[model samples]
Target: MSSPASSPSAPPDTGTRHITATILLACLGVFVSYLPVVGVSVALPVMQQALDASTEGLQWITDAFILPTAALLLTCGMVGDLYGRKKTYLAGLALFCLGCLVCLTAGSVVQVCVGQALTGIGTAALLPSTLALIGHVIPDPRKRARAIALWTAALGLGLSLGPVVNGVIVAHTSWRWIFLPSLVLAVLTAVLGAVVLTDSRAERERHLDIPGQLLAVVAITGLVYGVIEGGSSGWSSAQVVIAFVAAALGAAGFVVVELRSACPMLDMRLFKSSAFSGAALVMAVTLFAQVGLVFALSEYFGLVHHASTLDIGIRLIAINGFTVVLGPLVGRLMNRATPGLLLVTGLVIGGIGALLMNAFQAGTSTGEAALVIGVLGIGIALAMAPITTIAMDAVPHRLGGTAAAANSALRQIGSALGPAVFGVILTHRTLATLPGHLASSGLSPADQGQVSGLVSNVGIQAGAFLHLKTPASTGQAQAAYGASFTDALHTCALVGGIGMLVAAVIAVALIGIRPARSPQTAPEATAHPASAAS
Candidate 1:
């Protein structure tokens, strides 16, 4: 917390060391922020076992981290613009590391969620700072594009590595141990950032938009809470209706607050540019499909296939591994290919990949599943860097921090909604179809009653693979559970697939208009130093 850094972008010189350090730390910062997303995803079944999490509770684990990250990203970007990027980076790392420590020893699911929220806050701070620092440190468009690609690749690498790391940790010891490596990485990055990073900020003055921020949080939180709870308690329930109403008011209020504010954290007029708005929507949709599929598939592999933690992680590699391998290349390709072209193409391919998952069954082979997953990953890799590139390019360099934060925030919002929305689909689908699946399994009358009661009380997660020991009598029950769950998985996959295709159509219509393409043409913000924390 120092005075406003209305100074120029930092590391004043483009020396090899400065550029190298900035890129490295930026990559690592994103790496640390995303490590938990899929890493914890692959461990969901194990976590369910260890913590006794019900279906909704499991979704909360992921959303707990994502909600805060989504809610605070814009505000945190303001912090970087007002304070220093390095300060925000360091602060973010410290909070993330502390959250890891809390998770490492957490005994209950709620405690783990509390820890995740802390990491989410840290993630919110880290994301915009890292990207903005890169923008500042690398002034050349080509070099910045490459750096952003590499930054995105690092995110892919983190996601790719999470399952492997978590798998090994869970294989050897407790699921809690999964947080240890991330904790270590956060500490190392913070220390290095403290030494190597230089301070930078928005060239223009910025202030906190506390009212807007609060409304954003309320809108996002209420929306997610309603969707998730609506699935369990009837969608028509009083609680769900109230939550939806609150969310609508909150969203409308945020827009009003931003419109009237002297110093808005995010200028409402920015969306007037099609590229900026399209990228935001696409970012949310892409993550919504990708993350939601992972949540559903993780359960499928673990529960239906009876895969071990290591097995589950290994199975998921193709989904993120392709992204890790292709990210830098995609960056290069952007120089030649139009971002809109690449973006639309990726969405189509990813949509196809998601639709293919409808073929996945309890007995599907690993090789069979790998093909679809690989396609999905490749599609995602192609789209990921472009979203960042288009969003950054659409805005002036001075607004890089705002653009990055907005992009990252939308991403997390989609991520939070993914589990909430997908989990609801899976829950309702499984429950609706479970009776037929169970009856077909030829379960004894007594067993049927008991199993139905268990699902009723504890949710569908009561039938985890670990709980379905394979005795002659129990074999029928396991098969029934598998059939029901896979049916749900297919439904989830279809939802994701259709979502991707729709996003593709959206990309075609937008991501091209750039009315305020240049800094000189763009409208300027009002000057107001008045501030408040979100």
Candidate 2:
């Protein structure tokens, strides 16, 4: 296909109208791509009832989308560079819309998983293309940076709003209706992009690294599958063991292939720069903590606190919603503070928030939880943009697109791992403590048997506990289940808190201030010369 840059359809002038249209389309593209990820977290309880899905099934619903997106992101970016960004982006929107339709009509959890995987494939193409198109259309460096900041804000807005939108939908209508808005937005974005976006690609020929891509897919899938299944099946089960082993082999093969490939999906040399490596590590750990915490808290609010879907969304907004306001402010702070300093400060604050959440009790109020969540929101807002800037700055401009993809892929991998790991912890802890809680209750043998039967097969969702009919039994069951759920949430909070603390330490040690350079020196050494520290 001919590059969009070479097409005769280029706009006569890069006027205000053209730029606004391009930025809005890019924002919509990003917003729709991320909306479903956290939105589904709020809808998991409803899904469990509607589809009779297990906890593992719910994890698969999220991971099925995340795994493909993480694995294919770099490859898709390269495809956009070699082919045409506009073409790939349009194709992604179409595929995403198709996936939404399948999900809307899904009758079973397996069908939902299939649809999620398809949507993930579409996102893999959409994300990188959106960013690449911005760089292509906005030739001026200052304008390009501003446009990218707006794109970042849109991403944060989507993440923040997903739960709120899903909550409203679930409260009033079926959770299936959640996809309708996204579908509509996707169609609008596709139409606008076709009219406004200029076609563009890399100046040089690029080759797809199929073997490396396949290895990455297999490795992430195996590892996540092992984690998710190990919680249900015994950890030492044959299936879990085989999955872990296969993941190890796939990971090893991926490293070897990338090191040797002429056109690697991920250039291994990026890791040689401590700033790049530190930024990438921060991205992974932050998402790990953030995503896992959101999943665990969503369950806590719904099952333990008996909050409605809208209430749960409002509660979560305290944690995620601040990004919209704080992102651009932090972007401005990039001029005053080193990216390393900003990252360290943000991680520390986020860690403190997680630690505070660990103090939650069975009777904790929504107001109390929101207080800590707001703190986390601020921390995340401070860290996210700076880390992105640092990672992009660490690479040469020529590799800027690749660097962004790599950072995003690692972040998605962390996102996928978070739910799996936290879910395992939540499930195991709840199960281990349930018998004790039940034994202490003044229940007759019949009631005990009934409650045991109800809870033994399900996760910590309220649907299982809500089945108790008698008032006395229901009260006892709620108390027991709430206590167990609180304990599990605390454990998850501890894990997430410690992960962020580690990230903070890594940032301090590895992310250094930029060295001083002569004014006459060429800017190629640092990818973002404008933001480089003295």
Candidate 3:
């Protein structure tokens, strides 16, 4: 896989002072993007209670960001390529800062959702441009790799630290403080970006694919909405079905349009290279498994173990901490080994770690849980950077922007879909087993249903399960609730284990053997090939 077309003219490498300033600015932008995701997740329970939000509303709060990020990523990349990348990036930060401020003052869930959307858009803008700018600014391949390594490290740090940071802020003060720090970071990054970043754009005029963009947005939004709604309304509901259908149709239209357009938003031709296709497939599956695993496990620790948001964040940090260390190493490994090897090894390790995590019981020791999660983190660390590097390497220079955008979009979608799909599984499993688990414990049928219902909604963390507020006949209800909660977690663990095993197979078979050759080979196919492959 080769890089996209070279920039019309590369920016000259500046002295250390300028490089340091520019790199710092770019890192800051990434840090700001990290704020909303980790910050909001920590605040989810608070947001739900404070706003009197329904399950649907809670889902929306999360979907609001994922939808926009997935929808707008390609468009933002195109915009950066067309206009000045530096300009587009700074503008994104400004919008993000404004959105954070809006979140601070949001009186309702709807308002917060809107603010989150804006933050998503800003994130979309920042993502591709950072890499594009790095490619532009650092002409040397080795130097560029190093720069990218630093950039990725910042991202790893931001994602990992985001929850911990929010945990401290939310615990000490209000959730509003989570948004407050972002305001300052956004402003600082924007200003730094303006002063330090070099202006870069495609010298040639590239017409915007308006219809393709619109259809892509519709498809992504519908998909995100459908996934979010499916959890509460049931996947069988007409509302959920319509949303999924709309998303599918819109996505189909997008494909049709891209195939026909002279300059498509997504060049479908990139799949020609077996290497590119392999890497992309790995990316999608890896993300699906990784994102889903994190969501399920985090909720399990918090709900079943009765951990606070801060405690949950700290526990999760063990996994992400490995990410921080492994991210740069993966980048360095790209210099010597095939990305395919790294991808296969990483996924297998991660899958194994996930399987081990399935052994966690409700009464499992904290040390055991932490060990399982830490192993999973090691896998994440090993795989993520190499996967990204492979995808970027797969495309040519001009398409780099699009390829990067698509990569980010798919990951976001995976992130969004993970929770919803797994949440459904968890809910169903809890409902099915809770009654039986509690029935023989001598609780009243009515009490069994109510306690089961609570566990279903919040998993095992519901305060009612902890004896904080028991029914009038409390003894039986308490024991029954505890047993039911344990049953729910057991079910989730088994299902999650199965998912990891499947992902491991795909990684091994689909990704196949690691390339002995250089990554610069032509992608198996072009973005818009004239001849169709059978």
Candidate 4:
């Protein structure tokens, strides 16, 4: 279907006011969408208790949102380009608001999962459209870079504030109230978007590759499901094996379909550019490490330190606060410094922070944790915007939506994998060490068996351990559980640090020193003419 143009009553000329309005709306849209990504982490323990959710169930609560986001992003980006960016963007906001309402009223974990899925779908639409609109509105390369950096800053702010805001809510009220801010922001963004943003789409008649889209979604869903379930269900279980096999087939089918399609959703040739591939990879790995670190640390603060929700948020400020200050600064410096250099430097710094976290023990001080987390915050701020700039710059201006979507989808994929992988590592390590601890505790076999059953699931293990009220053995149990939890945290940090180091290496190897050309100088598509076709 062809997209309609901007309102006929609107002015013919694109004014500075329109540009500013568009940027603001786009930034708010991005910020709102990202709030739930990490904010929900702070509320997971509360949500688990309220919903009586298992470890896997809690994982699904987060995965349900991330899975669809990762899967549908590329397809939705294409949809926005083919239909209309503004229209898609507004629709996304409305859907996001609806999702928030669902979550706000949710009575069960299943309902929350459904709500999160809807939000993810909305985000899949919102993210690419916002970036695409920015590309459409700002034609100048230098100016566009700055605008994108601002957009990235908005995203960083959302990520940084999610935990803090949600923590405060959980502290003062209930976890359900966490959705209120997102709902309010989504509505505001939608209203502003409809009034300010000009409708724009690719002026070409490209067919949507439905088969490729379906296959992509199926592949990502199956893969993420397998990873998430692998921790609870044995990795060798039939369900897990079947999921992996199906994912493999779906991915292979998607490749075949895309290669043969006349109009592909994602052009495989984009990966041919080392710069593009590297930037995308760096984006993925950065989130993988960052998200995993956050997940581990949030639990550490709550379970290990016995901190309240608000206190946990306050402690976490060391990790994400710098993004608020450094995001725009990095954007401003993009023209002066190579993005590759920034990406590498940031990754190295972040990796060091992750490595530092490996020293954490049951008795580690809060100040030490804050110092390490502060280093991580600086690294994330320096790297996040530059990688995005590099990725979008590498693609054709006309394909901005697709490029943005692909980059975002990959990052979401990494985000989904991070928690699952870390959770698995933590659960397995904890479980393995628990038996040794129990044996040494001199507990009777029956009591040991009961204890094992109680802590069988990683989701409730820490809380259960902390709240142990047995008069005879409470102290010994606490010490054993503390040691085991600390060991798991150390292992997770090591893995995260190694991942960041790998990303740094990739950034150094593939990212270039040069800046991309402006849209005016970018090549126009002659193969795919800008003509109206059914």
Q: How many clashes in each structure?
A: 0, 2, 16, 0
* Per-residue alpha-carbon lDDT of candidate 2 for residues 1-534, written as tens digits (9 for 90 to 100): 564364434432377786687778878998999888888887887888889888888888888888898889999888887777788899899989998998999899999988898889899888888876765566444445457667778888888888889888998988888888888999988998888777766655678999999999889989999999999998999999999999999999999998888878887877887888888998899999999999998888878887777788889886667778876777656655566777788898989999898778889887888899888888887777777767766666556667768888888899999999999999889877877787897767777667666777555564345556688888887787788878889899999999999999988877865532332333255444322221
In model 4, the Cα lDDT at residue 479 comes to 62
TM-score pick, better of 3 and 4: 4
Per-model C-alpha lDDT, please?
0.85, 0.80, 0.69, 0.80
- Model 3 TM-score on a 0 to 1 scale: 0.88
Top candidate, metric lDDT: 1
TM-score for each predicted model, relative to the true structure:
0.94, 0.93, 0.88, 0.93
Q: Report lDDT (Cα) of residue 322, candidate 1.
A: 77
How much lDDT does candidate 2 score?
A: 0.80
1-534 in candidate 4: lDDT tens per residue?
332454322222357887888888889989999988778876777787788887677778888888888888988888887778888898888888888999999999999999999999999999998898887777566677889889988887888888888888888898999999999988877877777677887755566889998999879888888988898889999999999998999999998887777788887777877788899998888898888778777777766677766677777775667877887788777777777787888899999889888788877888888888998889888888888877787766666777788889888988888887777887788777877877788766776666666787445444345434476666666666777778889899899888999999888788755554434554333122211111
**Sliding window of 10 residues with minimal summed lDDT for model 4:** 525-534
lDDT of 1: 0.85
CA shift at 219, candidate 1, in angstroms? 0.6
Off by more than 4 A, model 2: 1-20, 137-145, 444-446, 462-469, 513-523, 527-534
Pairs of residues clashing in candidate 1: none
Query: Residue 270 lDDT in model 3?
Result: 64
Candidate that would win on TM-score: 1
